[model samples]
Target: MTAMALTQRPASVLSRLLHRHEACRGWLLLAPALCLMLVAILFPLGSTLVMSTWSLDGYSVDRTPTLGNYSAMLGQPMFGALIGRSLVVATIATVVTVALCYPMAYFVAFHVHRHKALWLILLTLPFWTSYLLRVFAWKVVLGYEGVLNTALIGLGIVQEPLAALLYSQTAVTLVLAHSWAAFAILPIYVSLEKIDRSYIEAAADLGDGLTRRFWRITFPLSLPGVVAAFFMMFVPTVGDYITPAMVGGPDGMMVGNLIQAMFGPMNNWPAGAALSVVMMLTIGLAGLAFLAVGRLVGR
Candidate 1:
């Protein structure tokens, strides 16, 4: 009995410690997710970081690590240009999507008295289709002699199809905006919906107008959602190669297109990895800047 009691004492103490320490219990609960992240995300990032330091020797990889790829990027103007273009396009798309969707989200949140779920479903219905299909659909609509051009010519709005309508920076921006509209709408709606009506009522009782109430109470309260929408929209758009490939011609080729080329036809794995790392770092910095701006605005 004394031997058995001694054997159980350590196990009991450990059990009690685990039970008493909320942080330990919390970590235990989170262990599965953390392990999955380690496998899926961190491992790949680590590999990429290592790969970025390696170089290619004609038809073979030099296992010796060097910063030649990073140095090459610094010397090349094209790399900087493409990255800048991607940043600009993504920023424009995020701004446009959020600006356009805000009113729709506000209407749905404030004006719709019933069938709110149905409205949300309807709003998101377009996203249920394949993203590729949506991009192609936009391509068709914006293409020369396509729907919009056909209508414009038929109605005497223009005698010729607008070549500039498709395969341009504007086209890329427009497609990105349309693609991410739902993402923007949902967050803004959730934020607006969660706003307390009593505050608005209180403001009204104090003789404030609708615009003033909205700017002061509603908009401020919904900034979190707006910030979320912007972040969500911006991050994905910046790395999008597909939309640019489909709608953006040579004039609108972004960093993602270049990155894809590097990994594909260029067959420069180290350079591609280095560019990817740079893009990831750029995104992290941009995201941090966005969060800082959001905090400042919130204050």
Candidate 2:
């Protein structure tokens, strides 16, 4: 009986300790994920930050810490321009994707009574194919003498194919918006679907019109999803090199392209790492600003 009591006493003390430290217990529950993130995310980020501080020597890494890479990045106007272009392209794509997808999500949430799953499946059908294939399709469509140009020419709208349609910032934006449409739509639909109809119905009962009810109750509640969509779209788009490489000609070349060049043909890993750090910091700051704006709007 004394032995059993002693064992139970430790168990009870442990239980009480855990109960007192709810946050500690929660962290224990999340330990696996935290460890994985520490290994995968933090380790790589720390390596990159360390690499950013190093410089390249002739045919070898100097392995000496220096701020020259960051200094050069700041002193150079070209880097700033590319980063700005990336931000603009990403921002425009995010806005266009969200704006276009919101109505579709709203329709699926509010109007689709039968086979909601089917509607969602249909909405996501375009994403079934590989991302590259979709981007290539856009390229074919936007190319000079492509389908759009051919159709317009046949309709007598123009004598020649519009060269501006492809290999431009606009082209990059269009491709990005098309690529991320599903990502923006799903979250928004989920948010709208989860909204209690009672609030909207009450607004209607109070003589509120559709727009008023949407602005007053529906939109505010869905701001979380909207904010999530914006973040998901904006972050990846800013660092997108593939779309820009394929279609973003010289004028549309972004920071991602430069970073790729630095690591690839240029073989300047340290500089690339520095640029990567700057890009990550820029995205973080932008995300914070966007989140703040979303919170303000929600209020």
Q: What is the C-alpha RMSD of each candidate to the true structure, in Å?
A: 3.5, 3.4
Q: Write the per-residue lDDT of candidate 1 for residues 147-233, one digit (tens) a residue.
A: 999999999999989999999999999999998889999999999999999999999999999999998899999999999999889
CA lDDT of each prediction against the hidden true structure: 0.94, 0.94
lDDT of 2 by residue, 1-299 (tens): 99988777756766888889999899889999999999999999999999999999986998889999999987889999999999999999999999999999999999999999999999998899998999999999999978999999999999989999999999999999999889999999999999999999999999999999999999999988899899889999999999999999989889999999999999999999999999999999999999899988888
Per-residue lDDT, model 1, residue 31, is: 100
- Window of ten residues with lowest summed lDDT in model 2: 6-15
- Report the lDDT of model 2 for residue 94: 99
* Runs of candidate 1 exceeding 4 Å displacement: 1-18
Clashes of 2: 0
> For residue 89, what is the lDDT in candidate 2?
94
